[model samples]
Target: MSFLAKIFRRRPRPKLDLSHPQVVALSARLRALHAMPISSKEEVAAWEVEAEKLRERLYEDYKEVYDSLPHEIEHYLVDVDIRAKDPGYAKYQAEQLVELLSLPEEMPNQSPEPMPLKRHGSS
Candidate 1:
């Protein structure tokens, strides 16, 4: 192979393995924690810390999916417990990391905030 060809070629990315026993167990625990109803500020604080630890562990074991995991986690954590709705939301987010990894060359869709609309007559 020519030197330039070798230099310019993109190396294959490392595969993300979601089936590891430790990962599976952690995920299950995360899901259960998320499923628990939020009752007090103290519990929420505890879950937040727990989630941070899980995020760090996933970062270490699956660097390939690290960039995507935080988004899923944040999406759940922001919800207000309104009207008996979506429980176990964190598990859904945790699943999203795995789902993104399964897709071919799919990066997390980090949508930017929409620009504020200006009045046509105003600046």
Candidate 2:
């Protein structure tokens, strides 16, 4: 959530996804880092922090997919099968993000009034 979201309004928090590979890989990497030496405390700390961030981002992506996954999303991707989890999930997520980004331009209040149309020889 952003400062603006806090002050104005906030969208619902997304659900956690345990199955995404990025989530699984980052968790494994974090565990490995923990098992290694802590001598270079700063470097280790930095990597640990980065892994946490990746985890959060993957969770957010999954949440967005869960929120608005359309049936058409399955058929939409070329050379990809919806039965395959990641491919299906990504199509819906990408579509959702595109819709959100395009909304501002669609708001009636944000658009200028249309020019009046004239009929030929009309008073």
Candidate 3:
């Protein structure tokens, strides 16, 4: 790989941060525990114990990244104003409901010849 390409390469998003094989297995179990339907108080107690162990392990593994996150810019919001003139095909009056609305002069249809509508009031 070129030096510039290596430097500019994008890093993949972090999923799990634990180092040990047993701890990684425990982490998957912890996630499965959250998804499972537990009925008894004993099950709940066991879940809480597993969760606390996982939490401690994760904090130890990624302490620097976790601590620095609060100081870093966390959220981003961008406001944009979009002004669009209605394309005018969406609605029509009850009196002229029988007649089809012609496409706008700015936008021509696929038809070879567009027959202009004769208004009731206009000449």
Candidate 4:
């Protein structure tokens, strides 16, 4: 019931410019329509009509680009020389695993008496 709804209700067939604010306004409108209760026939009809309009705008405005994008960044290849490289990373991980595996067997669960470390300068 705001002014934008009035402007949008007019089936003025201009292709939605995603680069402009109208697309954003349409998106907000769609969200509002979606959030409304579905109990009434009137609300359902309005939602359907608006949604079809939006779909047309979206398809007409921008069709080839798919919306669902993977979260990963597709940038430059991983540095082969760095520790992050799969081979190098695996080697580093193996070294850490080896260190962990070769840890001195847990001294039988007896309480550890504090050993006094030899201090060189300060007593």
Candidate 5:
């Protein structure tokens, strides 16, 4: 093979292995975040921030998977961005993540029921 060809050729990306320790840890963190309760806008904002950070870590540590699944990752990120603005939507997103990850519906230390989302102008 020509040197220039080899230099410009794309390399095969590593596959995403869920059994990897780092992936397992990241998944666990995501599940824990999903189970956390948020009562106020402040809490929601904080939750969103942490979730974004986790997403960044996942992308950085698993760049191969991220690159291989651009559509899936972009869809997930967009959904999260849209839903994270409201508590109800955020909870729904979390539930969706749990389902996607195949995590147990009931996590230890998580509340048995979803918290009510307070309406605007309500006390």
Candidate 6:
């Protein structure tokens, strides 16, 4: 590779270390939130607030990872109303967030890359 190419080539970002104390605490908080019972709209509202707070913290502390997250996971982080209305879905979203933070350091494809789409009726 040429000198300029070497300098300009993108480097893979280091993965989020799940074993860090702060990450562990954040994961625990998400699990706790997932386990909470949703008995009423008030509870759901409260849950939404807590989830948003967690999302903000995640984004603030890990901006690179947050920005690189898959679109579905990012959507879950932003869509409070949908999560509030469905407890099961909220749990799933929380799980996804935790998994995101806990991803192994050596895992491949940390960066988003486009995959070829299959054309209809082209088996």
- The model with the greatest lDDT is 6
lDDT of each: 0.46, 0.38, 0.34, 0.35, 0.53, 0.55
**lDDT score of residue 76 within candidate 5:** 49
Task: Please identify model 1 stretches exceeding 4 Å from their true place.
Answer: 1-18, 64-71, 77-123
Residue 88 of model 5: what lDDT? 68
lDDT of 4 by residue, 18-102 (tens): 3334334443543344344333455445545655665556545533321321111011012112322243443443233231112
Query: Tens-digit lDDT track for model 2 on 22-114?
Result: 434433543343233323445445544654554455445444344433333223222122212353453343343332222233424333333
Which of the two, 2 or 4, has more TM-score?
Answer: 4
Residue ranges of candidate 6 with Cα displaced over 4 Å: 1-14, 62-73, 84-123
Superior by lDDT: candidate 3 or candidate 6: 6
TM-score list, all predictions: 0.39, 0.27, 0.28, 0.29, 0.46, 0.47
- Order of models, best lDDT first: 6, 5, 1, 2, 4, 3
By TM-score rank, best first, the candidates go 6, 5, 1, 4, 3, 2
Who wins the TM-score comparison? Answer: 6
User: Cα RMSDs of all predictions?
Assistant: 13.5, 21.7, 24.8, 28.5, 8.6, 11.5
lDDT for 85 in candidate 5 is: 49
Which residue pairs in candidate 2 have backbone atoms (N, alpha carbon, C) closer than 3 angstroms, thus clashing?
none
Query: For model 3, which pairs clash?
Result: none
Q: For candidate 6, lDDT tens digit of each residue in 23-92?
A: 5565566555555544566766776787777777776765645544444545664665666566566546
CA lDDT for candidate 6: 0.55
The candidate 5 region of ten consecutive residues with least summed lDDT is: 112-121
Error of 1 at 114 (Å): 29
